[model samples]
Target: MSHLSPRLMRAMDVAAHAHRDHRRKGNRVPYISHLFGVMYLASRVTDDEDVLIACLLHDTLEDVPQEYSEGRMREEFGDRVTGIVLGVTKDDSLRDWRTRNEAYLRHLAHEAGDESVLVSCADKLHNLKSILADHEVLGDGLWSRFNAGKEQQQWWYAAVHKVTSRRLPQIGLNGEFGELVRVLQRL
Candidate 1:
């Protein structure tokens, strides 16, 4: 069974506060909902609290550096959780979406640990679910929500599934992610 210590509760506060004002793209849904969704999905696959915490805070460094930095995260959650969060974070300084995503893919393939991979798979899975759900309602208009359009989005999700599935072939989430990527490809 998974244990939720005080540390996990503290991480929840940190994530909720950091993303308090943010909303998901193309809609007004609270961004913290996505964080919680990732944590819940990761929880389904593993009991490691650190991985679950990383799932909660995965987007902090990328989305809200002003609210939470690497140093602050380390001070609050220790190295392992911080490392996993860093593993999934992309360098926002790179303005070009392709350049940013390429760097992220390299980090995911070479530098991320198993914990990071697990959190990333959960993160992507939650994102895919959100995208598919939104697409069903918004149709092609949903593509406008992202920085990159449909083709680029397809490329990125497919590439992520390829890397994540290879890294974690045993995880059932990867299988689901691959299937979702195929569904997205057809749209």
Candidate 2:
């Protein structure tokens, strides 16, 4: 048996349907792998069920279409899980990549709470690891798949690392975040 909590299994089911149409940028990989990676990392750092469930659903509100509203999510997953998803959700109406990312980093710095950062850190760590892996094979071509180039991508990850790192010490999960930051820096 896989031993997943019933709540987590339900979260994964919802996230799978929500992200069903999406694919990773550089390859044909399903976006669900990214979600699972975030969940795996977050589960490693903390046993909090809400955190784990949030990790699975983290990208749903941001990436999926209007299939699931925040209210609907709250109805399905409760306040804490929905709140984490909303906290990590970006303002999508903003036009450009840099502008959106800058706004998100700003929000992380000024508005987001520690629980929000905890979930966001796992998502960023998984993304940076994918970027590093794709960079190995795709080289400069990999940057073309994303909204920004290598330098801009690196900047965004570094920025998230900075904001997320400060929050991690308080949560006592600083080492994992630190290691992710170091790997991101090296990449």
Candidate 3:
């Protein structure tokens, strides 16, 4: 049987509510679909219940309704789940998106073994894969907005390589992820 319990189910419901009106950039697909994709990818690695739950709700505190406070998250899902979610949540007080993202990535790189990394990587891999797929449809505009610049792009590729190289060896060095990494390196 799957390890997803009633608490996880409730948490997913809360995330769905929080992101109800949201859509991904470029395409208007429901944002929760992205969360599902990340969870699916994480499932391919370890079935650690906390990791799966974190994958499902990683963005709730960041992208969801303002009412979804850390306190509410702790009350509903307990402190550990809140900690994992907060570990991946970006501090929006930064003046620039790139600075915020860089700090977030640096934090992840520092907090190496936290289950949050698995969710964060799965989340990033999902976005990267979508960016690759969307590139054919959106053309250069999407890449232009997402890439930040050649140096930032190269740093991103290198950072992803460092994390995945250390953490995802069991996920194998083949398939969509491997191809995506190669493409990022070329950018």
CA-lDDT, candidates in order: 0.90, 0.80, 0.74
Off by over 4 Å in 2: 170-187
Clashing pairs in 3: none
Task: Indicate the residue-level lDDT of 157 in model 1.
Answer: 90
Query: For model 3, how does the per-residue alpha-carbon lDDT over 75-147 read when each residue is reduced to its tens digit?
Result: 8778888888888888878868688878877787787455777777787789878877787676666656653
Work out the TM-score per prediction.
0.96, 0.90, 0.85
Candidate 2 pairs with clashing backbones: none
State the lDDT at 74 in candidate 3. Answer: 86
* 93-187: candidate 2 lDDT, tens digit per residue: 99899999899888887888777898888888788778878878877787788778777877788788888877666654456556766766665
TM-score of model 2 vs. true structure: 0.90
lDDT (Cα) of model 3: 0.74
Candidates sorted by TM-score, descending order?
1, 2, 3
Question: Which one is best on TM-score?
Answer: 1
The number of clashing residue pairs in each candidate reads: 0, 0, 0
